[model samples]
Target: MSAVASWPVVLSHGPVTLRPWRLTDRGAWDEIRRRNASWTGPWDSTRPHDSPEPPLTFAGMVRQFNRRARHGGMLPFAVDYRGPGERRGVLAGQLTISGITHGSAGWAQAGYWVDQRWAGRGIIPVALALASDYCFFTLRLHRMEVAIRPENARSLRVVEKLGFRYEGVRQRYMHVDGDWRDHAMFALHVEEVGPGLLARLEDQP
Candidate 1:
């Protein structure tokens, strides 16, 4: 049986629901990859370099999702809308806990991507808000960090809209496109978590 065989893992506001990635999601996931190929190619690390195509099978995605789920270090979920029958959105994201240390710096890094079509729909902010809350409250984590390419203005806005503070810059932090690129570090601590996040979408114009 799969780790997420049990239903309804985590709940959040909006039609957006975070649940275990299902095998049925393969088709939609592939469509998303295909649609966003050009938009996501530069920043997405999972995109294969050799093949100008999406993964041949969902088995690879299933294996990757299941491994992270069981590993406990990371919990990956398929972002969908709660409608008539689990209608999936164009966006998918995950929360990763790494280098977990006790007392202080018990932090996890968060990374996410959205279908370009859903870019300005405020989906990413809500997802980030809920995920951050889970990290601070449910996971009992001290901090959550997001490392983004300095050139990614949209991503910077997402983190900033959520009230994350700019920490510093890491040179050659992440490999984007092909070469290692500099990244701007942003973080939010447990104490910083509050009701303010609930109003994030409302603040959007």
Candidate 2:
């Protein structure tokens, strides 16, 4: 019963848009990462010292994302925001739906990061809601989860605003900032957001 979309899918709401990452995005992505290195490093995932996975270049990363997307394993989106009077959107961040499982499992997890310049503007929540609705309705996934470092208060608020329930914590769950770090798990089921996640977000005061 697994459902996956064709590659290069795009989702949008108001000023925010989620689209496939492009090779041309290398420059902007690199610049943002450079400026925000200190801002995002503490919570960002890091390869374990003992692991054999090679580091990925920007092009390599985009290629891998596209390959996984074609295989229905992941949705790697480059977040864009089109502000007033701008002819085009600018890359503002990234949101990825990874670890998708079908059949009885029917679940997936989402992870995201925004440029420091875009933080505190509610863009991540919009991007998250768009992605979650796509999973719940279009992909027919049963559950969606977000794992956050307990210290990431900003990320915690995004899930709270969307009404995802706090499930529990996973100790030493993932390698982050050079070591295995604990994560507080939060989740939402399709039944819980009956209308749709995006709709729920819009209805929020």
Candidate 3:
């Protein structure tokens, strides 16, 4: 586990925050999933029709993420944006540091989704940069990876902007929508960030 036991409770940079999932987040999760259905469905992973567990349910999701965190194999976070809000934070989507491996590998993979309404606002890249920095600094991890389907231009743009070096293509990487999909992999080591990803973004106009 990371040195910080309270990891993922909340981490912020500018208007973006990556925090742990909460049971009370059910309403927002349901609403956003409904609104972003067509926008996000194509990229989302799917289970076979005969699968026993439901594809997604808020309570089940909360329990699943909490368990991963407890065993130190994952750090699942809900991404939020605070943009001129009247008060509380609003859920934009989610980001997860899953399949975390320690010891020799020291590796982890990041996965995320942003509400369609928030697209083109640079939320995913900034949030990812934040998460990666936390993993490198707080967790002392060696490598972080983000894999995106070849056709997902929006997501591809994110890693491009963040300067994640392209690795290669993975054939039939995972089940997406209703069939297997290929993905392009990108990765960055801790030493590459220099001053940090958030800092780099801030230096831009």
Candidate 4:
């Protein structure tokens, strides 16, 4: 099996940090979701009508992510941002590296969301760079992918800014916002960013 980081691994770049979720984070997480429900609902994935999987609560989701992490199939990160001179960090969002495949494939997908209040500050992009670097250097994954709904201009710009090469689209790729939706796929191979994605982000002109 390919290598994987232990559960609760933390990755950081400046004020943005990606760490595992805690049970105590439910309150803050719930508030963020509730407040941003309208903002994020359109892009959020949904269960199909015929699907057998039950809805997952915050605790249940955390447990599942942790269980998957043990087997090297998932990396669930809760994004935290600490402003300059701040002693403690506040929850900013979440980024999960899932769908990990080992051996020949050696690939994984990253998905993320940020609080509207914290959006456009380069936090999620930094978080993505950190996660991608960990997957490339630490876990030794070959490629990292990000799928975004076609209409999500904000998210689309993120991949563009981070230099993830456009890899076309998947028709009816995933159920989202009450129906199956096409997603624009973008990916970055380890070889494509030898200098590291984080450094590339910092070097943007």
Candidate 5:
């Protein structure tokens, strides 16, 4: 069974929601990525040196995400949440369940990014818990892994907040930003959270 088929198109918790990425999201993406280049570029992944062709167009990126969703390899989502009379759901960031595996593996990898403005608001941990719980319970995935660059303290804090067990450090695990970078890998098994990741996190005070 495909993981995407069993999941909600829009997953919500409190005022936060995670909906699949869309072609119409280009504007928001452009605005955020452009304005936050100094903040996000150091962590964003880049193509290999030998790869031909220019970077993907916004439309192409959306098409690729849609294709991945259909293939069951990923669920690309846009994180939306409400804030002090700021409208019901603002585009806050993105969270995705990528590299989904089924059959005997029954696992997936998670990746995310939040607008800097939303940092320290407890929005990320809540969003992550919601996704993690859905994967463990509804999708019946046995494990979920989150790998973060060692220097990405904010991201590491997120896994910690949710109590994802640290597995190990991966040396040059991925090509991030420009060069290969080491990452701290963390994971959670279905049994690790008896109640659910969201329930285990205990909403911030």
Candidate 6:
């Protein structure tokens, strides 16, 4: 069986710290949600309603994160940028491990989103590489896959840049922007993990 099948609360990288979500993050998280409403609406699942009140309250968000963690179905993390002993940025993303066919499949999936303000700054790549390493090294998972919308060029670039192989399109695979969207599938297997991933940020010139 893959280690990820049984592992819980695995921290991959970063002082780039990937930790459980906190209530203190509500203000910053809500602000980003408000600002990126339109920019992310087309692809994100949690866009708020037009009404004055948010559909999900701060406490609700915490409950949901905790529930998922308890089930071992997902690990939702609040990614923080640590510099000079302060949390500088938020990388909002989740890593999901599902469809456990009792170590037979040995596969899991990953997905992530960075605050738009931090896009193109290489934060996603670093976080992705760190997460990927954890899946292979710590979790002992055999394969990890990422699916991206075709229109999301920035995301596509991240996957390709990381050397995740093109695995073709998954038709109407994900519910995003309130509709079923096709995703271009990309994957990296256990054999593909290596020190090369460490050079991803450095080689991005």
Residue 119, candidate 6: Cα error in Å is: 1.7
lDDT of 1 by residue, 48-152 (tens): 366576663677766776665565566566666444356644335433334434355567788877777667766777777776666566667778889998888
Model 5 lDDT, residue 75, Cα: 79
Ranking 2 against 6 by lDDT, winner: 2
- Judged by whole-model lDDT over C-alpha atoms, candidate 6 comes out at 0.68
**Residue-pair clashes per candidate, as listed?**
0, 0, 0, 0, 0, 0
C-alpha lDDT of candidate 5 relative to the true structure: 0.84
Q: Supply candidate 4's per-residue lDDT for 106.
A: 93
Best candidate, TM-score-wise? Answer: 2
- TM-score comparison, 2 vs 6, better candidate: 2
| Residue 34's lDDT in candidate 3 | 89
Model 5 alpha-carbon miss at residue 48, Å: 1.3
**Which pairs in model 3 have colliding backbones?**
none
Q: Candidate 6: where is the Cα deviation over 4 Å?
A: 1-15, 46-56, 83-102, 199-205
lDDT of 2 by residue, 56-139 (tens): 999999999999999999999999998778979999999999998888999999999999897888999999999999998889
Q: Which consecutive 10 residues in model 2 have the weakest lDDT in total?
A: 1-10
Q: Which candidate has the top score in lDDT?
A: 2
Q: Regarding TM-score, does 1 or 5 come out ahead? A: 5
RMSD of each: 5.2, 1.3, 1.9, 1.4, 2.0, 4.5
Which window of 10 residues has the lowest lDDT sum in candidate 5?
1-10
Error of 1 at 92 (Å): 5.8
Report clash pairs, candidate 6.
none
TM value for model 3:
0.92
lDDT of each: 0.69, 0.93, 0.85, 0.92, 0.84, 0.68
Per-residue error at 115 for model 5, in Å?
Answer: 0.6
- Candidate 3 per-residue lDDT, tens place, 1-205, comes to 5553354457887778888888999888888988889999999988877779766677888898888787778889999897765465689989999988878998899998899888878899889989888778888888999989999998898888888899999999988999888999999998898877778777877
Candidate 4 lDDT, 56-118, residue by residue in tens: 999999899998987778999999999779988899998999998878999999999899988
* Ranking according to lDDT, highest score first: 2, 4, 3, 5, 1, 6
